[model samples]
Target: MFRYLILIMILSITLAGCTEQVKVDMQGAGETIPTGSTGIAFDGKDLLVAKEGLIAFIDNIDTATAGSIYGYEGHFYFDRYPITITSKENKPYITGLAWQNTAGNTGFIWASDEANRRILKISPQGDVITRIPLTKIYPEDITFDGEYLWVVDSKRKKIFKLSTEDGSIVSEYLSPVPVPTALAWDGKNLIVGGLKNLNNPAPSPDNVQIIKLDPVSGNVMENVETSRYLTSPAGMVWINGKLWISDRNSGKIVIISDKGEPSTDIRSYKLPAVAPVLKKVEAKEDKNKTAQDVDEAKRAAEEARKAAEEAKKAAEAAKKAFELQQKK
Candidate 1:
């Protein structure tokens, strides 16, 4: 009998361990951008998002409005009438963008159009100033240093510095590896992320290695170890000395401090499963028991059950709300 009781106790303990649940508390929930969105840049207070054929300027980043631009489409300036720029007969999908002041009057925004294999120079008001055709390379991310606009070619695994005034290649530096996704300029150095081996059949790990590159020579200066929680980072921008990355697969945004520590600030919405409603479990089983004892037991059990029910209901309500919001 003693042996049997010990065996039963062990089994019960194992079952209890198996039933334990893991909880993940998120900081900023219900904040997300559209799928397939790649590059993001902040313009002081607003945010610029590049996705597919559209480049939109969001006036408010805290409360993002979908498919809305404060200025005109294909235009850059936030004030005055909208100026539409012609693509110079090339309908390239714009991937990355960077702003620079060339002269006192003229401000230039350099945008890399990967589809047409060219980098375009546009005026502040969205006029096609010039387009520099790139051969044997596909440009992905772009950033502006003090003098030049640095562009990343993921396929060629090279970083090219182009003149902000005219679309001319100033210098080109070959990267150590392939699959460069995002670029961040830290005043002194450039940080690159998004490493992937497409040939491998198995799924790649979630961890993305952040490599710091010397802007002048385009050589690897140092590498920062990132969190293993990120699956694929598509866009990254440095705000107030912190690096913010958007995970494409998870539909979430992660904030990484200058020290290379990462934390998830956004969460993706998931639908709740349908379940049958059940009656509340009662605690008062013995009618002949003392009134006070029965009352206390009933109240405790009712409170516990009510708390659990409220949690489950809240989860379901959140799921439903998310689904409804997505439909809009």
Candidate 2:
């Protein structure tokens, strides 16, 4: 009896070790482009992509309005162009998008509205459900980890933990990278795609690494280097136990395993004839450009330029302050 008990314990330990082991194979994977693919979400059938203000479908890219499989025959069954929400008197500048099944009953697409500093929850059919306001931080990428929403603020260099029910920030932490751009949640780790300072633009050949973090505390766990395959990895998603990342500058969708190994059967697909729908908002001014309007426009441009500089300085100051507090 004693020998049988010892054998069972040994077998259990071996099985547990095998289940937790990960193999990363990013090399040797076939590379493909999804045409300006930024943020990606899979709805078990088709992949949903986030553009400036429009959503595109990975399977049916040609469909102009119907970017999601939920779309009806032709018209976009989900949200349409000219997003109803506006910020700074302009349309919300959408950066990232994610699809979630609420309570396992309703479907919601959460968009990171950088311009407005908020996250918009809309129905697949383009109806506004509610807006979650996140002030001061420029939200770039977002992901859902079962019960909570994790958002990375690019300018602030912080990862915010938000309540899935109301969007209120539960906690925030300084990200390991200075310019964190994308986020993906594996069952066990929070993967962050980031770059060094945006001010120092690195050449394409420069190797970069994505950091994995402790999901609960947002502490750096490890950095996985993508020496050859990923160039400027931006938006990322975990699908079928593999991490799919979109390279902003390269315009390629890269697939890699948890261990950073490329998938063997990597494949690429041709984008449909219809080009991506670019957001074009006509100026609200009258047809004739009056001298006063022209002068006002010039003045406004100058103010914007100065304001941008000031904002950058303020962001840096805030970051330093936060870091000091963390040290304490």
Candidate 2: list runs displaced more than 4 Å: 1-34, 60-88, 103-106, 205-207, 227-229, 260-328
lDDT of 2 by residue, 1-328 (tens): 9999999999998897652322222223323323456677665555666656666544422221212344322211222232343455557667777778766656777888777778888787678788878765688888887777888888878887788777876667777766788888877777888777576556452545576777554456666656455667667887777677777766556666656432232221111233436698666565356667889999999999999999999999999999999999
Candidate 1 at residue 195, lDDT? 72
Best of the candidates, lDDT: 2
Model 1 regions lying over 4 Å from their true place: 1-31, 63-91, 101-107, 200-207, 217-219, 251-253, 261-328
The residue-by-residue lDDT of candidate 1 on 152-235, one tens digit each, is: 777767766766565566666665445677787777878777775645454344445677676554456665566544567667
Clashes of 1: 0
What TM-scores do the predictions have? 0.56, 0.58
lDDT of each: 0.62, 0.66
